[model samples]
Each structure stands twice: as C-alpha cells, then as structure tokens.
Target: MKDTDTAEETSPEPKGVNLFGVDPLIIQDHYEIDYRHSYAQDSPFFVGLSKGDLLGSRCTGCQYMYATPRSHCMECGATTTWEKLPLIGRVHTFTVCYYGGESFLKETPFILVLVEFQNVNTLFLSRLKSIAPEEVHIGLPIRPRFTKAPTFRVTDVWFEPMGST
Candidate 1:
C-alpha cells in the first residue's frame, strides 16, 4: 500500500477532555424563535385596544356581561357577543407584585388591579400605572390607557388613576 494511504488508516482519532468531570455542568446560551398564532374568536378584543377601545363580551341568552372577552357564557353556557366596555372603572381589588414573568421582571414591584365597571358582571384584570401601590384602594377610580402603536397584546392596555395624564 502507498505510504500516505497507510498513514491515514493508522492515525488515531481526536479526543476531547471531560472538563465537567462528575459534577453537573452549566452552559449559558441565548435562544429565540418566531412564533405565529391566531386569536381566533378573541381577535376583536385585541383589535379594539388598537383603536383606543375596550371590548367585552355579553351572554346572548342570560345577558350576563364580562369585562373581559369570552367566546361562551360562563353563566348559562350560551354564546357571547362583543360589547363596548366603559373607559372608566373602579378598582375592585389590587395587589403589589414583587415578582413577575420574564417580560415584567425588570419592572418588578408593579401593581395589578381587578377593575370593576358599572353594570358589568365581571372584573377586568390589568396593570395599574402612575400611582404607588399603597395609594390603591378597593374603590379607587381608574381608567384604561391604550398604546398608540399596539402589538395586539394584553399589554397594549393598562389602567391609571382617573384624571392622571
């Protein structure tokens, strides 16, 4: 056989060290992916926020109202229809969040509120802004503010104490 061919066949394979040994190893990495999804029946709610409107759902059979969108009625198992919700509502309840999900982690210690509107059967959950957590109360007047350029996300709308700019 040729010298070059014999050398190639006999060369040892390369090896890597097991740097981690018996201990657990950690490797930091950044991962991201583009995800596409459809809101289907709830599309109108997000669309309304983009146009500076808040949309809710009402039961067709029982006339029960929801401050948040619902495809079906929880009260009577009936279908729901879209309804325009009032811009103003009152704080039904509230809490100061010391920990949050990844998107809100940097804004820790924020306030979340359950907003109640007149004639609406259910309360809407939203982030509260422009006020200290201690200032929030059971009946504090609140109003929703929309993002000028909406991303069709729940984050597009938030609540603030009424009369604040």
Candidate 2:
C-alpha cells in the first residue's frame, strides 16, 4: 500500500471554497429556520404542563429536584425519576421586559420572574400573570396559571401572585 503522506500528496484538490480565493464566502446570508421544534416539548415536564400539573425530575444520586425535569441528572449523570411538584412558589427575582423579539414585543411590559418552589433546589423562569410590572417584588408569593383548554407547550406555564401581605 502507498504511504499515507505520499497518497495525500497525489490526491485531487479538495472540493470546498478556499478562504484565500478571489470569490470569498458570502458575508450576508439569511436562513429561515422553519421546522417543527418537536424534541424540547416531548418530555414529561411538557406533558405535565399540558395536563395542568407541575412535574419534575429527581436525581437518584444527589436527590436534586428539577422543576423543569430532564431525563438525566446534571450533577451525577444518573437517570432521573419523574415527581410531582407544587404549583405555588415565590418570586426569587424578576424583570419587567418592555420589548424583545417579534414574538415577545406583543407582550411588552410583562413581568418575568424567576420563581423558587418551596423546598426545591432550583428556580424556574416564567411570566408573572395578574400582576402589574411595576408591582412585582422579590419573595412575592405566586402560583402557576395554566391554560383552561390545555396547550401542550412550555409557554402555557405562567405565574400569578397570591397577594402578598
């Protein structure tokens, strides 16, 4: 057999646009990413969201309860088991988004909160409902407001304050 170095030396030219070529790569290209995003919403967490129940994953090794459950644990790489979580939580932190991308621009001046479920190790981000953006505060008691007709999507999850004292 011919030596690899010698073989490569006699090989045909590679079939790609070289960087130093006269016709350089196109600097402006817009790709429309239009396809069904099917994987992220296929988990037990999304199923529970559709059913108006809070579901999570518990790590068997470290006992970490993820509000938005993944199939595996982030810490120990162990398989996780599905667990039910309470809908009620408190606002750990928050922001009032006045503008964002096209989809979010329609919902301007909305309160987005990072919620900490009672006794859970992690916090979850969701939109705060039934509360004005100016009224949101840290440690505000909140509960998830699920759609009545049940849309099987993550955006179906939002929170409402429980009237803090």
Candidate 3:
C-alpha cells in the first residue's frame, strides 16, 4: 500500500523531447514552447564563424581535412591542426524543410545545404540563402554571409550563391 501510494504521488518521467519546464504528459498533441540553451565557444568552429572565416582541421595520420574543425580526426584518431579555408564551396546536396516537426515547424520553408569546400575533405551543413527552392541545385557555388555583429553562434552566418554558379 505504501509503494502504491508513493507511485501515485510521483509523476511519471517525462518522455520524448521536453522543452523548458513543460510537462509532457499534460501537453496536447501540438503545442508551442520557447526555450534557450547555451553552446560552448571554445572550439575554432564558433570562433571562426564569429570572424567570418572558414576554419578547418587537418589530420596528419590520414591527411583528411575536416571543415567542421574538430579537436581530433575521425579517421585513425589523431590530433588535428587548424587552418583557414577559402570559405567558398559548392552545394553537394540539400533538403527543403517544409516542416521542422515537434516544437520546431517553421512557418516558412527553409533549405539546409551540405556544402563541399575547396581543398577540404569534409562536408558542412548550413542554411542556404538567396536561392529559390526551384533554383537550388547541386554544384551551385556558395559563400558565407557573415553578420555585422556575431554572437559566436552558428546562426551568425549563412551561405549565398557565389554568382550564377
């Protein structure tokens, strides 16, 4: 009886993705939630983005380059060295996000593109800009559009067409 009472008194553990202090069990199928989270800025990724520069990491083991600029290489597991990249790339592929789902679901559709930078062995994904959905295609040249004032977040930059490519 004590166990039963204790169980009844305690709420069930929250399931799925809970945004903020929202109780999932009490929430309906569709709801809106506003929340904020902090991201670490100790890496070159955020720092380079803040400065409008494309930084990459090169692996000495396999000589593979990472555009995302990690501390270590994924292949063969070696420490990476940082270098500045050209900051321009071609669109390898992309997805049109008509619906983001759950707490997301943007009102307007947006394009998330996977770009291949010059002399880099890694592919970077970010929001694609200045291109219509109908005009978006593979192999389109893109360049970064940096904010005048950067918050050192990934949102501080986006990619735009590099002149008719």
Candidate 4:
C-alpha cells in the first residue's frame, strides 16, 4: 500500500530478458525501483539478496526471526539483528496475477506468495519460479533460488518447489 503522491512516484516501462534466445518478461521498473530504494535499504534484505542467502531479522532478545529485516521486533519492540535463514519454507498464501502493471511481467501469469519456514512461523513474501499454478498449494514446500543478475549487484529472490532440482 503506497500513497499515490510520493516523491518516488513515476510510471515505468517494462523490462525483458533474453532467456536462452527467448525474451522473458520482467517486472516494471517503477515497481522494481520502488522496492529497491524503499523498504530494502535499511534492512539486510539486500545484503542477503546480494550474497545469495535468504536473510532475516531476529530479535536477539526473543530469538524471533523474521524473513525480512526490520528496525524493530514486532513481538518485543526491541532492535533487531540480521540473521541468515534457510531458504526452505512452506507456502502460506499465494495469488496468481493475470495482469501485471508492467508490460514485461504481463506476458506470463505469475504467482506471488507468502512462505513460512519449517519449525518457525516466520513468513517471507516472494515469487514462485518454474512451477505450475495448478501445482501450487497452501502448504507446499519451497526453496529459494538466487537469480544471478550480473548487471546488478543484488541478486533477486525467487523460489522453486522443494526437490525441484
């Protein structure tokens, strides 16, 4: 949820990549830039993204680990420290977007999801990769895939069905 009149508000064109001689659509630049410069800066999310690790913020005081870093803990209101979490989790929620704001992403129907780690309830919002929409389930296991973006230092977070390899 964002206010319409923010300083960063700008319309962006979609991006595409040559995937094995085929052009694959990407998210719109406006949305991508908004996400990169906004909530991601202060958090260790980018750090993990760069290192190909799924990082989270943990309340050192309460040992509550969150998939994405936050300034403070939701449970205890204490400062959080970054922790690298395992990429394994179960899908908690998901949605298939038929219409992507960006023309690039609009080419293919994509799945957005919230996944929860095993033994821990911490959830991370991400996209499903290389999986069919019909195969996705509320409790399907998944693992992270760090897309190697050579042009950008920060790797992108994508997910695959567990045992996908």
Candidate 5:
C-alpha cells in the first residue's frame, strides 16, 4: 500500500448557500449547519449552560470524563455518567479570532482555547475572555464564567483568564 503521509488530499472550497433552495452554492455549509444544530440543541452542553454549571460525562466503568458530553466512552464504549466539572484548567492551546460570522459576536476579537483538566485527563475547547492577545499563552490558567440570559433562558458559556476576578 502507498503511504498516505506522503500524499496530500485536495478539494475545492465550498461556496456559500445559493439563493434558491434547489440550487446549492455550497453543499458543505448546509451539512455543517445541520450538523451543528443536530448536536448543539437540547444536548447536555445546552443543559449545562442553562444551569450555570459545566457538565461532562464520564465512563462509569472507566472513570474518564468527557468534556464535550459524549454518550459513551471513547476508550471502552461504556455508557457514561453525567457530572459537573470544576471550571478550571490550563490552556494547552489557543488562537485569537478577529471575526465571528454570527451577529452576536461579530467583530469581537476573542480567544479560542483548548484547556486541559489535569485531574480528569481531558481537554475542553471554549472561548476565553478578559485577556489581551499578548497575555495568552500555553499553560495559562483559566476559569469558567457562568452567564444568564433574559427570561431565564441560558445562552452563553464563557471563560476568563485565571486571577482576573
């Protein structure tokens, strides 16, 4: 067999949606949006946001917590136990985004981070706040910021640099 590492997979970029439903400027965008809606709504992630707590799932048999709330353990395929996790970790990786396609976050420069919960042996990718670009670094500590929405609808999950409070 040929080595895949030596080869590159190339494809055309998908265009945005077309004006008519029948016509697809970019089919991938439609699938991407559908994928997000299917997973993001009514899941444990949303429920956790509503409660002002970070929720994760753990393999009951293995004691491994899933930061993104999966149904089964990736390691053992066992049913997971739901639990709350302390909103603390260190940034294992991060990137600054200057633009958000959505209206709510448009033009807001924000930090996208992957934090490693050392105790759980898991990582969470989330948005970070209250820190300048120069201050962000690998292994920087951070904590969650629970926010409430109008009419009791929980909406946002935000985190800030540690010691910012």
Candidate 6:
C-alpha cells in the first residue's frame, strides 16, 4: 500500500553484516570455494614431490638450469628437460614473514628461503622449518623433507636443518 511497505516486500534478505568505522567500512561474511586446477605441463614437478624427489628444468640448448619447473628455457627459448634436483642445498637468502595470503595466514611468522644447490644456476624458493627466524642465516645447510601423505602440492615438500631429525 505505502512506499516503505512496497520497498520491504521487494528487498532481498541480508546475508552479511556491515561494520562502519574510522577510515573505511568493513563487511563481514563467510565465503568458501571449491577450486579445481590442473598442473598440465607441470605435472611432473608435483609428482616428484610425492616421490620425495625434487624436479627442475634444464635448458637443452644453453645447459642453463632452473630450480623450478619450466617447459621452455628463459635464456635460449629452447625446450627444457626434467632434471632431478639435489635434496640438499644451502640457504642462499631468507626472510621472516609476519603476514601471508589466506592459505598461509595460519602459518604466519614462518621463514622463506632461497635455496642454492650445487651446479644449479638458479635458486629455489621454499619454506624453511624447524628453525627460528633469528636462527636462519646465509649459507645454512638444509635438506628437503616430503610429506608421507602427499597432496601433489608444492607444500608437500619443505626444507629443514640438515641435522634435524
């Protein structure tokens, strides 16, 4: 009958709450997603993790090595081949992360390191565990440890101090 009554009849139910504050307003809501993805050309890399093997790419043309998977060489533009990387490497560099993305948020205050392998031209980026952030140092010897139950994700493998059990 009235404008307010008509508006209420057509309005949809609210699913979330909005909070107004100092600078910007915040909306709180629950969100979820079921994401499906394919590794495709990078399938071997993930598979190697499940088998406790670290796989990389080697340029067939220039012989350049990459610590990460690649189907083609960035240097020579040539097709690359899969190479098994050494399980042991040294900390080329490192940083302590106090914040991270949604997946890693729970694992905040973690350490990320660039690992240097013998004869490898590029460094591999991975999580360094079992050590304090202040204890991480350059050239620190580390070794890869694979999860017993693999998820075929990069997180299936992480590095820890060589002597740590």
> What is the C-alpha lDDT profile of model 4 across 1-165, one tens digit per residue?
367676545533335635466676656664334344455545457656766877777786787778766778899898888777886888999998787765437446989888898645477887887888999999998998886663233227778898897
For candidate 5, what is the TM-score? 0.68
RMSD of each: 10.3, 8.3, 8.2, 14.0, 10.1, 7.8
Which residue runs of candidate 6 sit more than 4 Å off their true CA positions? 1-25
The local lDDT score (0 to 100) that residue 49 gets in candidate 4 is 78
lDDT of 4 at 157: 78
Would you list the rank order by TM-score, best first? 1, 6, 2, 3, 4, 5
1-165: candidate 5 lDDT, tens digit per residue? 356643334433345644445565444553334332344433666766777877778898788887767788899888887788877788899989888757437647878888788567578888888999889999898988877662223337767888997
Candidate 3 lDDT over residue span 1-165, tens digit each: 565577645766556756476655764586669867654433677777788887778897888998786777898899888787776788999998888755336535888999898788889888897789889999998998888898876767789998844
lDDT to native, each model: 0.92, 0.80, 0.79, 0.74, 0.74, 0.92
Instruction: Choose 2 or 3, whichever is better by lDDT.
Output: 2
After TM-score superposition, what is the CA distance of residue 34 in candidate 4 from its true location, in Å?
A: 11
Show the lowest summed lDDT stretch of 10 residues, model 2.
17-26
List the candidate 1 regions with Cα displacement exceeding 4 Å.
1-21
- Tell me the tens digit of each residue's lDDT in model 1 across 113-164: 9999999999999999999877889999999999998999999999999979
* Candidate 5 structure lDDT: 0.74
Most TM-score-accurate candidate: 1
Better of 3 and 4 by lDDT: 3
Write the number of the candidate with greater lDDT, choosing between 1 and 4. 1
Alpha-carbon runs more than 4 Å astray in model 5 = 1-42, 104-107, 150-155
Clashing pairs in 4: none
What value does the lDDT take at residue 39 in candidate 5?
A: 49
